[model samples]
Target: MGTPAISGDPKPQITFQTKGITKVYDTGDVQVHALRGVDLALYEGEFAVLLGPSGSGKSTLLNILGGLDQPTDGQVWFRNQELTAASERELTRYRRDNVGFVFQFYNLVPSLTARENVELVTEIARSPMDAREALDIVGLKERVDHFPAQLSGGEQQRVAIARAIAKRPDVLLCDEPTGALDSQTGVIVLEAIERVNAELGTTTAVITHNASIADMAHRVVSFADGAIARVVVNDARKPARDITW
Candidate 1:
């Protein structure tokens, strides 16, 4: 795909921009402040890793960017389009056409084969790659006919990845994608994500508590106490295969 409008020279196009974003959830008698005055931008085609402790706003920020949740305050933009001002229906369409998501759980239908699971998304997409091609991208072409029950946990996660990217989304957001797997399995999942970012140039952002995973990102955003604590640009990125616990 071609690049979006350039925000400036000498930098990749900005995919997401958030200004003073805040989110507060009311649980009857109590209120939880999730994000507080977070201002950040994710660059096009750059792989970013979000690192923070639990309840530190990393996931909250990601959810807002992915259009899964709306913030209580501040402004957010997908390229030049303002997401904070979008209607719910528009947000739904935006997510469907532009964003791809992967979570800790595989969420594959038990009875569906790996290719069939990925086909669920491709069937509804405007212009999608062949389901088998998507599976191939994640190194699962051989297992395309295998049911979820027949695959290992890592293989299942790769199928989830294939489902997400089958639509050729502009941005891929991963939330604790490898959280449920062992180190070896986590590495495999990470490699799939890395391949998607590198091969397809899908702008990618991952939420990971594992600090070692930061080496695989072009930049790392660290959150603390519902705000951004620091942002680091990696001088050189290490492949997921070289990343060890």
Candidate 2:
């Protein structure tokens, strides 16, 4: 269902809307419910953090929104298009043209330099920024020629972020983007994400277990038992650099 516009109220555009979304995985012996009737709305140019412990369904919801997976029941919308009703080919195109994903691991090809890694995405994108430009956005211009082995953990993650943003995607979905790094290094990675959201106006959603990171988001959505427990809108968002843990 489409989000109804309120009269005399200027609502920010909804980038994603999910209604009664549910996901069930059959693992032979058990049917695991990954999402339980989740209703969510994400606004354009907003930074949202999905805060929850492991197995809380945050990642499952992200996967659905990113077109990586489908809901077993209910519907999902990306702007005007109904993702749940989309064909496999359409979903593929949707992921390629609009969604950018960053995972817990920096899935970089070890042999490729940072610039080359970013280049892989740019070449396939419909309208892409220069590989160096993408690296610069993540503060990795100097390390563009450096291989993954030459860079630190945070630097490699930044490279992954650069590759994700190179396509200028409408949505950026990050699943535990900073989970592997120390606090200092994690902050650096978050800064890159913050900068990307601010400068490019990408609708960004990040999944994290760290409560401290919630302060950086425009909205914090807490999940529990495969359902959303609460959603807190941050009246005064903190800068990523100021956050610890």
> How close is every model to the real structure, measured as TM-score?
0.95, 0.96
lDDT of each: 0.91, 0.93
lDDT, model 1: 0.91
Q: In candidate 1, what are the lDDT values of residues 1-245, reduced to their tens digit?
A: 12222223355878898899999999999999999989888888889999988899988888999998899999999999899999999999999999999999999999899999999999989999999999999999899999999999999999999999999999999999999999999999999999999899899999988899999987888988899888887767899999898
In model 1, the runs with Cα more than 4 Å from the true position are 1-9
Question: TM-score of model 2 relative to the true fold?
Answer: 0.96
Q: Residue by residue across 1-245, what tens digits does model 2's lDDT show?
A: 22322222357789999999999999999999999999999988889999999999999999999999999999999999999999999999999999999999999999999999999999999999999999999999899999999999999999999999999999999999999999999999999999999899899999999999999988899999999999887768899999986
Best by TM-score: 2
* Number of clashes recorded per candidate: 0, 0
Q: After superposition, how far is residue 64 of candidate 2 from its true place, in Å?
A: 0.3
CA lDDT, candidate 1, residue 107: 99
